[model samples]
Target: MTSPALTKDAIRAKALELGFDAVGFAPATLDPKHGERLHAYLDDGRHGTMAWMESRAEQRISPDALWPDARTVIVLGTNYGPRTDPTAIHALKDRAAISVYAQGKDYHDVVKKRLKALGRWMVEELACQIKVFVDTAPVMEKPLAQMAGIGWQGKHTNVVSREFGSWLFLGEVFTTLDLEPDRAEVDHCGTCTACLDACPTGAITPYQMDARKCISYLTIEHKGTLDPDLMAAMGNHVYGCDDCLAACPWTKFTKLHTEPNFLPRVELTAPRLADLAALDDTEFRQVFAGSPIKRTRRNPMVRNVLIAIGNSKARRLKEVAEALSEDLNESVRETARWALQRLEKP
Candidate 1:
């Protein structure tokens, strides 16, 4: 007697039932062509201070190289599209322009918990070896996502879905099950420079990104004083920037995510720059307890607030910027000096 096989449709159904917005599968044997691109990007020093991306370049490009036993890779997408226009805060100079993705609970916790649920289900039903990965791993999720038909990597270098637009949070599950793969999505962004023209720092060049000039990198991963030109271009974005992502035309199709955990907290939407600048380490930790902003630390965050105030030309924040000018951290003080100069300009 022949038993029924575990089908791709069945796996996808289960994944969707588990609350993953979109799901697709691809062979673990993804093409290694991206490895060459990674080397070129790193060699040009385009990655800037993100040395970790360079350190794990090998495991990042080649899925088979990362895990030999993996035969199928299940790629998942969770939409974190904003309930409101992400760009609206820019006009409110006194408020911070936090990236929409970070305005809610951390996706790592949301997606990883869901991945574990799906993985455990597969292990019991199909009896396959499995591994789950969030962004913590060296996985090239964007390329792998393109391979799995989740979406095409758009001009901004983010996976853009026609359905969810540029708001998908990606996760991957590696399994020994040899399920049929989905057909890859072709590049749909034809002659559209919306994301490119919209970048405040011009980080996106056609399909390639210069992470050195990227505002997200500047405000997040970057550890020291921002370049003078980059600081001027940063505007009021304190934690991360989303100009490119919000500019994608496909975002019109995106809907507000219904998951309670993914919903934006009221305070993160457009927090007062003065309030943020006043946050001590203890207060900062308490306010951003489960938030991704906590990783940016006190000094850099304060540095950003001062810069935003300087750019706003609000006389009130001059005192705040003045106080931060003598901050203990050299980077913070450097930014504070720049802010003071911007404010002091006649």
Candidate 2:
């Protein structure tokens, strides 16, 4: 086993060498205020349909609650910044606008594989016990990342890196080794309301968010027909919304990511809503193979596509929405009806 004094630097160097854009260390504990905010959010039903978040509330409050033996957390950030503006697709009402994060191969697979590699190295070299997590676990990654000094949580409630902007994919390595913690990052948002103002559905209010009103949550996590007002506010976002992230001024410092795994696929960049509406279950699975969008599955995907079609004023997509009026899923069928009704209006 290596000396305890050398572990922190060694781990940081190894993580950077392994393609992580940013790395930081934080203790296993969390501030009381974070827990209080989480409880308040949950009590207010801000998490919406995500019941799992509530199930693991205590564990998510502090890393120690999840693993008492964990002495420190190693946070990793991978930059997936886009070459083009993510919000630009909103202008092309006939095209489907998938979120920038979902435009490539699934980030969970990419970030987790790298995290496992780092965990294995720590176990082999430093003889430390470790567990790795991507988004699947009950970890509070954003707050932990902020505490580790990788970035601050912006007013939009997503991490904003000074160097990588709003484009980081986060994962964590919890270890028994007690490494020195990095100074926590201070909030740099400073009176900037760009993210809040960019929200189409008024889901964001400074640092807090109502997931029920968020387009990203509505299109992905939501399991039923959406409110007509929210559907109209969603614009052409068929998968996830990037309006708040794109509006952040910090993004100006980020360069396009060169990672092959994160580069946007041509088909997802700006697909025709008509083409997306025509994707049957098998075709939906095939097109989104190895993508995060596949997790949303065909039913909800079709439902979201139908909503986008409704918001699109293009007369050409009217028939596309009509064909799905009797879709097997009630949400899809309802959204299709809404789309037909919307398209019929002048």
Candidate 3:
């Protein structure tokens, strides 16, 4: 009832034809060393308040544990490299610096659509069972991507490609087909500490990250109020941070991504801190509709915007911070007070 098994080359060609920039096959099972590293990271409490990492440890470390029937993993990368310097917004003190990844339509929506297309192809052609995943799953995508030879996890702990640098969005398809695995990529980050040195909050060391101190984690994931020190270091990054990713030397080989869905939206690329800080729940939802920033919601986003306003030291925005000092959300109110105090300082 099924067509004959397709060659790895055929699948790779199909993925490219579907607009994926990188494709490779890897065994569904992960190397034990990778699992060990994850255990150690979780043990050290480096994941911050992301409790799912602890709860989902078993499924995340082993693909077999997640889906025992999976024999081959098809790793796919879509390029979302920025057309301009992503770090340039920092110099414009009043504007919020959103991470390059969040500047457009949500990647989960964009990447998953392609993954399902690829999955449907495999089912129709080989009659194989397949499961597709993007970041919505607990799969260790960066490690699996390295195993698939698409790229290696660099010193910053994000996968870096020779072709796309730090700009690839990873997704995977786990299937019953036993395709030949590609040679695992070796680390190309020798002696490079650019990502470490570039981190304003020192969240990274050689190849490890402490999410508690990461600006991206603080701005996007952490709930409630933030530490004053971390808030001060956040600069104008209101949604997500990109300093470490933008600092990678591997990015010299980066080419602008052609995907229109991943292109930066004009407003998100240079959102004014004052405008963002003033957004009500409904306004926030409307403005960030269809964007990743929508998940962040209003209170936390306003909290982050307040921190950026505090760091701005532009006394003109002091009244903006004061206006939110009595916000209904305790966290927003506290952050607004902090911003007001910081702005009042010399």
lDDT of each: 0.87, 0.91, 0.92
Clashes of each: 0, 0, 0
- Model 1 over residues 28-57: C-alpha lDDT tens digits? 985767888998999999999899998888
**lDDT (Cα) of model 1:** 0.87
The digit string of per-residue lDDT tens for model 2 on 190-246 reads 989999999999999988999999999998898988899999888888898999999
Off by over 4 Å in 3: 1-6
Better of 1 and 3 by lDDT: 3
Q: On a 0 to 100 scale, what is the lDDT of residue 52 in model 3?
A: 89
Which RMSD does model 3 reach against the true structure?
1.6
Per-residue accuracy of model 3 over 107-181 as CA lDDT, tens digit each: 999899999999999899777899999987989999899989999999899999999999999999999997788
Poorly placed runs, candidate 2 (over 4 Å): 1-5
